[model samples]
Target chain A: MYRYDEFDRKFLAERVAQYRDQVRRRLAGQLSEDEFRSLRLMNGLYLQLHAYMLRISIPYGTLSSAQLRGLAEVARRWDKGYGHFTTRQNIQFNWIKLEETPDILAHLAAVQLHGIQTSGNSFRNITTDPFAGVAGDEIEDPRPYCEIVRQWAALHPEFSFLPRKFKIAINAADADRAAVKIHDLGLYLRRSDRGEIGFAVTVGGGLGRTPILAQTVRDFVPRRELLAYISACLRVYNQYGRRDNLFKSRIKILVQALGIEKMRQEVEDEYAAMGDEREALALPDEAVAAMQAQFAPPAYADAAGDDAELAQAAASEPDFARWIERNTRPHKQAGHASVVISLKPVGRPTGDCSASQMRTVADLADELSFGEVRVTHDQNLVLPHVRKSALYDLWLRLGAGDLATPNIGLASDIIACPGLDYCGLATARSIPVAQALAVHLAGREAAIGPLQIKISGCINACGHHHVGHIGILGLEKNGAESYQITVGGSDGEQAALGGIIGPAVAAHEITATVDRLIDAYLRLRRDGEQFPDTYRRVGLAPFKEALYVAR
Target chain B: MDDPTFKLVTGNRLRDGAVVYFASAGIWTPRIDDARLVEEKDGAALLAEAQAGPPPHPAVGPALIDAVRDGDRVVPATLREKIRASGPTVAYRAA
Candidate 1:
């Protein structure tokens, strides 16, 4: 949606040149590993377990079909013919070569894509609801504001190096699909009594060793002052956030120690000190209108045959009916629906889209949904503006590519991190655990109803196990893989951290343990009750009690 | 607490970041099978020597990891190292 202008093109070109030189220096022995590490990290080139992993940003999880094709080209040419979509709504190429990154980045620049701020202690990719502009409940499109922040934070000298990596998510919809609460800074658009748009900003909510929900600091800040207000919040954190201990360095830890009131006061004091600079940083009305124009709502055709065609298709193929029920959502446009192409096929690694699949989705985006794609934070791709009449055709094409898995909110739609399999920091394996759970739960997932299961290889919580209704955190215990389960975690507007239930189960027992937990939920749940609702009704006691029951 | 009788020095190849094991004659090989096994006595010394080289080493982040000879093959002791020696345990990218 938001195409890069000439200025953006020039800015990206210069950055690529710098990265190319840094990579060249490293390869030629002009720079040592220690010296080159930070530079490489800044460019999102990580030296993972088996090979280098290059994380490319999809700003606010939005992409054009052409950009999707460009990513496919990078995966096919330089990587292992596939890319892993991550929890941050970005894609990571796991098999990248250290020397080939510069060439790959240059290729990405051709399609207005780059890996900047996808890693390091910098402002990471700005994420938002996959159903951003299209969601029926949205107050306004948040993508324009997300784009604004992306430009402001990219390589900002003041925030280039924070205590640790920063994450920000903005949501305009009632449904918190972006997991806005579990970020360094979270923004929700609100309207004042005068009907002017403003932000309900939250600070210091994150998940790592210490997970905390973001506390609302500024209930409302006017639209024009958005940038200056956020700049002040970051300035406070930058000035006083911890730098001594690596584990205790996230803004959440700072917020925890200082308390929310003190932290709010500090940020407010910083805002007051900013004074005239705040006026200088104000977002103008013209700028807002310009951004809105770029993300303008697509022209919807008043197709008369949509309902009849959908009914006929559903009657013809029950599988298509199941898919429509699971993978599609209501749209703001009367004749349209937002389609989620499930990346988590049963028995496959979650979020690993093949080169051909990327190419196929890119083509499908153009053919069906206005040539745009949105990646979900839960490792799925969204065709955000699909016509209701085109739904059947979209399903047929997606099915052919094996992208039509009808398990959107079901147990099999797992979210997992690249754990010991790919990450050097992981103590235990996560991908295998996710695979096993997906395979075990596939046939009966429909019966289980809407559920969220997330897995992380370690406590870094990349898989966002902290928010899963059934969260599984993998750890190494006595030289063997062990998994700890949590219950009642949610990442929606009513955000929460999960509670651990008893001892960590051995690797072999994980699937069965999860099965028992689900069975417990089924037994305890009332009609139409989801996993989190059931968990809340019947606390962790019943789940814990059921976990180690005689099998 | 981490006393394994046998060990092998491992790192990633500089150019490609491929998992490599320290072999004989100051060479690094992608295959763990070709890795030269060092006893606990010589493991620290070999690791130090490999890590102390001048600018631009053949491999980076060299460290000693426990490994034992499983019949004719030099297999890594831990699952993490085993996964590193081979590729990811899960079949990804293809599907």
Candidate 2:
């Protein structure tokens, strides 16, 4: 939770004024509609099928209770009482009037939030592992670096207009929770042999008409030179990147055309030419120091909290025990447990938050845990630094609020984008399709086991359906809502795109099809095999047969 | 689909223009009374720019200016979409 300094405050104020003028001109007919479209896009406004949709950046999905309350107020006053949290960890107000957008942005700026770079062909909101500081296996917290990248990329005049929208993700933990491989640039922060922090950089990952797992551009970029390396890479793409063909305009396409070795060499050459100018990237250590301070674990009594007593408590509350086993994880400090607030309910829209629910989370954070919340790339929230002494109490409160679900990295948890309900580009309804599938899957709750089901409205792959153990893509065929299923897709230490199961099924039949596919996996899988493992073992033939079986 | 009516709405080149169409709820409405022919300066710049790429752009939707036939008179396909997003610039209606 980095507070905006005077400089940051002034910068946002100026941006607000600029956008206000842009909106005024558009409305007054001073600027042509076509000219205003680009400007509006840069400000994160889109004229969709129904009304204008405004996307507001949540900045790596971190929010204060006050900020969350601000969002709740926005939903109640301006929007439709709920906001759709996006795959990029941003939020979208789907039904905003064209004229009221400037006021919306002004309100957001008041809370140090703006929609800049949320759209257009610019640097998108940088994402990281939701369990950054709390994860047991992480080397260091990745938020400071994420913030640094945010400031550097926010208005970088040279690289503002990229050939295509670019996404960057960083992960410091052993598990790649950020899905680093599927980004324009993915940085893995790991310690070198000498115990110095460094990044393993990869480029060209995306899931659109063209789905590509980025190629590794550098094995190691020293901690001090991370910014330089990134600037150099973007410069290389900006200079030689294709503008002639929109399809081939992405840096990934360029990287693909020029081979990894050639691309790496070109980046290195460009970086070398820039020369080490420390002044250009003068990140205030004090700013990062303050952010780290904000995220520091609260003071807890130094005691394992009577292990025998805890074991007895676990044995008593089976539900609580299950939640603790699945949802809670070890913290660096004793008597503290890192808590993950599950967004997946039995049958709710994935990554959706009602105004009340959002306020409750904010209040809970303020009272029980640290005053900080983190949004995962997977679209869940994390109270990373919580005291174990407060564990049972936190669980009780969360359970009352329906936030206490014992399914993390499990089958019931799903990632879905707002489809036909909100998104204008959508051809079919993804949320309802996901809801139906989740409802059906909930029946075989125990048998489903640990599986990842991600659904997208279309092939843009915003919901990351391509990388789900079982992927569902909602599409329209002759005005009928149809869904295409994919199996064997994964986004872990070793990532792979899923293979299509068979012909597209009607939206109504998707749930049954998915059930049959799971049944096929269950029948074919070896003992104790996870869904992904089973899919890898038997391939798609068995699942395909099961999915398309005639009633 | 019936023969699509088209018109020139805005931008010198179709590639640079943010061409929208008559979506379900009329997200794009007509901005003028009738189609306006691309002025000489704009037309030459558009042709020069169009050489960078072809017509009927991708990503957002179809290119409206692609229907231009008579150097000046906007074809039906472009006219229909222009009127839909911005409005008609001329009094003449489809015969």
Candidate 3:
């Protein structure tokens, strides 16, 4: 829960006023649509298939109870009474009116939130693991570093208008839950020989029209020099990244064309030139301490009976036990755990929350999780701190809002983009596909074990299909909905892109094809093997044969 | 090759961003049945009129989409156009 200082609050107010005037002028016929479009996008408003979609930044996915309730109010009053949490850990109101966007932004600003940098070719939300601080495996809390980056990158004049939109993700844990390998810039926190924390930086990784894994440009840069080193990387990219062609403008393409070696040399030269400026760019020790203090761990009660009470609750209710098995994660603090609220019930659109559900979650957060909520990159919500003794009560409260599905990383927990349902850029519908898959896999996911199924309607890969253990990409081929299946992709520390299996499956056979693929894995896998591990051991031949070979 | 019988001009309303169709009497309608179906020859003119509405234009991204007469009613020929004319195919939380 990082606090916003006076400067942050004042700047946000000024930005809101500026956007309000922009909307007023546009509505008054003073500015053309072409002229107003970019201005609106700068403030995170986009005209979509049905209406304007307002993307609000959640800055590393942290949300307070007040902010959540404020979002619910906006959704109820102005737009549709629902908001979609995106894969980037941001929330979007799908039915915003252009005339009412300024007021919606104003409502968000009062809660210390805004749509700034959620759109446009600027630094989008700096994301990290939802369980960053509380996870038992974490090296350190990543939120303070994310906040530091947000303060530097938001409205940065130099890198704002880049070759393409930039994304940065940091993971400081043994597990890469933040999908670091699929971002423009990925940072893995590392410890030097003397126990000082630093960053292991990777550049050029992305999942979109052209999917590429990032290459490590530098093995380590001390925490103090993060800003200077990152500045040099962006400076080199800003200098040489292609702007002539829209499709080939991402830094990944630049990294590909110039080769990582040359790009590294260029970045190093830029860094060396900074000299004393690098020292100036270094974050002061006092500043770092202050930021760290802002994210200090929440106080926990000394529990006399934590697991004893939890074991009794589990013994009394099998459903609560199942949910605890599937949804709750271990916390670093004894007697506490992180609870994941599933937004992916069968036959529902992924990541959507009704206004009432938002309010309910807000209430539950205040009651159970110290008034804090975190949105996951996989489009789920996390109550990052909860007593193990209170798991049954939390489960019961979540069920009232239909958020108690016991599927977290299961196949039914699908990640699909809004697609043609609400998105203007989609070629085919992705939401229906995901919903259908979830329905098809309803009761069998637990038996099938952990599988990641991600769907993207277009090559933009907003749903991150390239990183799913089982990826489904929907495309419109010859005016008909067609789906392409890919296997063996993952977004963990050992990340790999999925390989497309055969030609695109017809729309009618997508789930059936998934069934066959899953069956193949179940039949061939060794004991205790997940889908990706089995695929890695055996490659694509077995699955390919099951999918394409004539019976 | 058999092609669509008529062209329908459509865009989203500038104010609320609602999907709208160019209708008779120089007005926009939210329903597809009220849309004015122009012949191929008149398609360009209809699209131009829709795109170049009076100051403080009522629509954005106006375009001519192919449609065909279904008995007395008209329907968009492409799946994309039809989905746009109606809302999303699946159920959603509507306000």
TM-score of the B chain in each candidate versus the native B chain: 0.86, 0.22, 0.85
Worst 10 residues of 3 chain A by lDDT: A542-551
Whole-structure CA lDDT of model 3: 0.89
Q: Between 2 and 3, whose DockQ is larger?
A: 3
Native-to-model Cα distance after best TM-score fit, residue A537 in candidate 3, in Å: 0.7
Per-residue CA lDDT of candidate 1, range B9-33, in tens? 9999998999999886568899999
Which consecutive 10 residues in model 2 chain B have the weakest lDDT in total? B86-95
Q: Per-residue lDDT for A69-143 in model 2, tens only?
A: 788777767766767677787888755766777788888888888888888777999998777776788998888
Ordered list by lDDT, greatest first: 1, 3, 2
Residue lDDT tens for model 3, B22-44:
88545889888889888899989
Q: State the lDDT at B3 in candidate 2.
A: 38
Clashing pairs in 1: none
Q: Where does candidate 2 stray beyond 4 Å?
A: A276-295, A300-303, A306-311, A548-551, B1-95
Ranking under DockQ, best-scoring first?
A: 1, 3, 2
TM-score of each: 0.98, 0.82, 0.98
Per-chain TM-score, chain A, candidate 1? 0.98
lDDT for model 2 comes to: 0.73
Q: Indicate the docking level reached by candidate 2.
A: incorrect
Give the alpha carbon lDDT tens digit for every residue of A394-431 in model 3.
Answer: 89889978999999999999999999888888888899
Error of 1 at A115 (Å): 0.9
Task: Output the better candidate (1/3) by lDDT.
Answer: 1
Clash count, predicted structure 2: 23
